[model samples]
Target: MFEQGDWGSAADWAVAPVDHSRLKHPVQALTAMVLVARQENAAAAQKVFTAVCAYRMGIAEDFDRLGEQAADWLGVGAEMEVALVLGVSVGTARKLISVGVTLDTRLPLVKAAFVAGELDFSRVRTIVDAVDGVSEATVSAVEAAIVDAALQRPPRALANEIARLLIAANPDDAAESRKKREKHSRTVKITPDSHGMAALFATMTAAEGVVVSTRIDEMAATVCRRDPRTPATLRTDAFVALINCETHLACRCETADCPFAHLPAAEPATVHLHVHVDVETLLGFADNPANLEGHGPIDPDLARRFAQDATWQAIVEETRSRCPAKAHPAGFVPTATKLLPPPVPSGIGGAIADIKAAIDADPKVLDGEFPDGHGGLDEPPPGALSYRPRKEVKDKVYAKYSTCTFPNCYVPVRKCQFDHIEPFDHSDPERGGWTIESNGHPACPYHHQAKTDGIFRVVRMAGDAIVWVSRNGAVGITIPEELGGSHEPEARKPVKLTRPAPAEDPPDDAIYDPTWWEQHMQSGDRPPTLADMAQLTDRRLAVIYRELGTHYEEHLAILAARDRHMPPPY
Candidate 1:
């Protein structure tokens, strides 16, 4: 629709209109333009990095010839120069330069992909680091098989795939590699956490680690048999008590052969572990991993070991309505999910009866679970003066946005405070925004403070659409997940237009073409020459990228020659 417009001048462009063709017009074109831009930008970055590699290679090859005296007299060092300019440590600067050089010198297919911009630096680093010290023969074979796959995969996924490929290439080497990796343990590290606590982690053999973790879980359950602390806290304290030889101070489980049975111990406690294992894995006939609740899947062998001490309870997961429905209502205590053999959790009932009563009578909770209007806030009755939202309203509002409405801020909604998008009018409460889901959004304490201090302003649009304007004049939109702008329009908007001027392509010719090495590397036994582009198979041409790592006037010459002889569609 933009094609049929008189949109050359600003005035003409304003008068000329466009048909918002959902299938073909602006949206598709906009998406295509973004992808093209990313590809082009990546190619440009690759070209710069390629030159950086060449410079490093030159310095390395000539450093000895230049002599220490020459280096000092010239008032320069390539290493320090890169370090300062890139703001990286000297070691990092060296590696950055070396990666480019090594990639260009060895993996032609990888280099081609990088140059063409199909694979960005992160993906390139994955390939280079994986093949770093491998023999040239292995490197060549790995590169041939992995570059195309790498371009199609994310960095982490590509690394996993390469591990399988490398193992297949040399099983003996893989065994040795595993043996070397095993040497990395026999150490413990401590990292600080919130709440004035720290995590003390250990690295050990898998079998030993699983046994140790299970022991801690058992000891923790017994120690906290009647205590109200969370299972996680009890487990940590249990581990600490044992390691410090202070089990008597914390543990109170007493049973025959119990480690702390006779030392200020009481009733033995049962521990529950949720493990999912297939029959084949359970029988040692397969290597399929098992799923451990709370943790991710574990090794099949490890899963069986955990199952030995654990009494199995078959749990059929229940999928309920998207609405939490019963998780949090206007009540003080939430009812459990209505599953068969209901899984009632622990700890909540341990609260004092007085505290529960106080919570039940609180103004927020007294507002009742049901909303007065379609899940939105209701106006206060004529006699009522307070405008505070109900527990249900606040809970729904917080859960609606699981994170702070501030763009890129990850503060969880539970940790955030609800703020009125339009400041509540305390003087004339009803005239001001009502304290309801539509008027409220979760903002972390810091952001809430900022909003109060006028550093941020929020506007609630039609249907709870939040528009957050930042101190720096950035506007961010937060749409409720269920009410995203995904619905199709009822009718298309017809637009009148005249001829519009064409947008000029980038000053540099866009590139995603493959050169001779790229062609030769990917073609297997039969390779295509520069003149055989039209004869090039889709598989071959697919790997050939353009406007990437090695692009410049010199590449332009090669590209032009190939295009003139026989053109291949991009």
Candidate 2:
């Protein structure tokens, strides 16, 4: 494709090929990816933007040749030519050029995202539009807030988030936005239809429209019961009656005071879902952003106010168990069970404490948090376990990885499947892997399906890390988010093994002994120390050589018997 296309310059397609090995250090590798991705797209797009800019410059240069009289037209024809090609207004064309110049000179973060291939020209332009009102100083903070999100989220969502952050940073911006909207709002237009009916339309904010709609619906419901109008007719009449402060002429019947005529304002509903924020942000000590469901990054001060006035509930973590999510409990603060809860008193003091202890003591209660420096986290009990993990296990894996385990994939773990590293077999307990946290991890649905269908083989390594090897010998390693957590699931440094050379001697025709090996390996005792394996290599080699010799002798005997018996049997 590169050879076939007229990309203008071979240097344009001189980008480096993708190397997933670099992805081991995702942050750094992402830069190399940006260079290649940018060049690749630029080559494919024929470097049109640059060519257009050059063409515009050429037009300006032509005007300059006309001498002092053509000075006024120096940039005019260029912009007109750009506007014609881009199919945008001349003012818009100018703004695009200005933004391009600004991106080249300022907005380092935006420029970085652009180079990273996270922000294409369209996404970059969307961001520029979103930060249209931000000052120079705040641009960095705004860019930092949205760059990662813009990489992952849709342009509209990213724009909405940046908008909310802008509003939070300076409430004045919200007023300005409101003014802009109001300037373009409430311009109703009526046009007669072919059937002699007419339609009225007006533009308004989303909330305004929703409130007006809900109020009209409420009034229409009441009007429908008292009047014989259809639901549609009632809704129309209700809307008309609301603004007129009188019954609509179209209504065939009316009750005293006419409910639609005196419609009440829409009442807002309170939702109690989780909103993640750090301690500093929550206490108003920092300007770090807070995420809301529909509206992203509202002011921390506003959030604090909401938390203070709005009744909130938290799930209590017991001294040894996770408590059920109920409203505020006596002598206990509300902490969402989804988050890491603070340690509680280890001993029982009162009836409540006793209940908490009992609940905590329940064997069914799962413990799946990442192990700290201490090696005291709950391990799987000695027995065959179920094939499915508890919710706690899934959540722990998701939180630990934070993102999908697939190579070069950044899908959030919460949106992925919790897959078992080793396939569990309920019917064959000894060979089948257990339903334990150590065996399970989060994979995005696509990657999980790929692994399940044998597109890639996922092998669990020491320390709970996983390695994926494709059919064609491609390998990808996914280590823990951080080193030394939960089984220290980090790749260990390479080690050199020194032992007696295999060429020195081969195993003799000795008989095998399994008793000692069984006691050492399959023993239900403490874990074997490093010294055990290192010191036992001689005996292990003897066992392996013995098996190899015995197999050869058996094969020779079978072949000799077959050779002698073949002629007599024929």
Candidate 3:
């Protein structure tokens, strides 16, 4: 048995040692370790809450002399400071501060239990959130009722218990709160996941949710029996199709007799999808990964699938000539080269350039916007001399970056605001920043305000990398995704296996037959099973076998099925 000492502070308990040797069995040892870890985590959470409370108190005292407006700004600054130190978003830091304050001021007994390692943070958070917006007396009553169950039950069960207690104490208040949340907090969000996947979250009435789910299942079942997709996959596809306003989810079976083959092709959706892929991968010559804007890297096959319904656009890299001008033939004056726009690269670049050249040649394409060759790629367009960059510059900047340049921020460039790297001077344009690609980057609104407010400083290093330095001397570096450059998958090399030669044959009278053992071991095949060695006198060979006979038989069956043009066994 172990005894917990009465430590003066949470830190003392957090660092207390646990003796694992006291437990004789492995299961007992592991269980004891987990118990000790939980206690340590509870103590650590108590310490964190204590620190938050102390910091807020210090901030309030320091800003007491300042006016209300100044104090409000300092409060926001305090949250930002905490966010930077904790490496969390400012929203999360604000929530932590709120939770910490509530725990310290209202739930004294709960806080005491948390400090003593009797409850974890999840249950504490549940109780704190449940008591919010209720009367002080109601809070006290509910906390007293649920505190014991909260310590004994898991977080989910404890949440249910707290909800019941809250409703019992103040049914009208709870009902009003529920009504307000349902009416105001309904939302739809898409969270990006690893490998270019995303999870969709929607908050709506239970009735509406059930209807949508049933509709998806019905739509999924409409596919023919020959359809290769699983029911879950079919449901997902049907849902996506429904959202895109397609009339039906077509069967994926390639047979000519598919029942849904005669259905008319669905019209393209209005939604725009941005994909960045290399020319080689797009042409199926390589397998480099492609980046779907707002998401991370995706397989080339998926990118090609997206391209099936996409409108193609070429992104050409600009190149400058190094050679000097050549002399024209005698009496044959050449046209001025600079007067004409720079030549586009050849091959696919030239093909796309030809379209642009034809459009430039047409007077209608340049109609009101660029009356005098103002919309060319190399120079700023006319009537755009203001602080805002021209469309060409914005396009180039967006192409250069996939997301906001702020460190660790993943807001898509399409949704971010174009920020001038150097502050533009309205009084003297020539002395300040110019609206060009080199001096422009995208930044989310939050970090943009932080930078403008002097809470952070940003510098553009060589190769278009961004360096962020906080007021407290914290530094972070952000590298550009570079459209197709940074995300390209490196070529994988083939792996070679090196196996050492088998040792000399075992001596006679050994349990196993030396010849039979050497043949299987040296050929990288599995050893004989115990039944196979039954005829022999030795039982030691049983340890060497891995029961690979079933796997080998399955492999042979699969190959035979392939030879007969039959589907492989599951």
Among these predictions, the greatest lDDT belongs to 3
The order by descending lDDT is 3, 1, 2
Candidate 3 lDDT by residue in tens digits, 203-322: 886678899999888878767889999887898999998898777878889899889888877776776777877554554445766778787678888887777666555454441112
Instruction: Rank all candidate structures by their TM-score, best first, as comma-separated numbers.
Output: 3, 1, 2
Backbone clashes under 3 angstroms, per model = 14, 0, 0
* lDDT value for model 3: 0.60
TM-scores for the candidates: 0.31, 0.28, 0.63
**How far is 184's C-alpha from truth in model 1 (Å)?**
8.8
Off by over 4 Å in 2: 1-265, 269-379, 382-384, 401-404, 407-415, 459-469, 473-570
C-alpha lDDT score of every prediction, in listed order = 0.52, 0.51, 0.60
lDDT (Cα, 0-100) at 184 in candidate 3: 77
Q: What is the lDDT of residue 403 in candidate 3?
A: 77
**For candidate 1, lDDT tens digit of each residue in 1-570?**
012345465465232233345437666778766566557646555644754754554455335555553443221234433443344443555666766777768988877776766767777787777765556776676677798678679899998888788888977765665565568535786543443234677867667789989878766766435455677778777787667655333543334555544556333445565566544355444465465543334666677676656766432211121222221111122222222431232221232222224333442321222212212334353322345666666755664454667654556566788787666678976666567555678888766765675545666543344555533333444544322122111111212222223334432332335543344334333332222322223532323321121222234445544444443352
TM-score of 3: 0.63
After superposing candidate 3 on the true structure, give the runs of residues whose Cα lies further than 4 Å from its correct spot: 1-24, 43-66, 70-74, 221-228, 246-248, 251-270, 317-385, 482-570
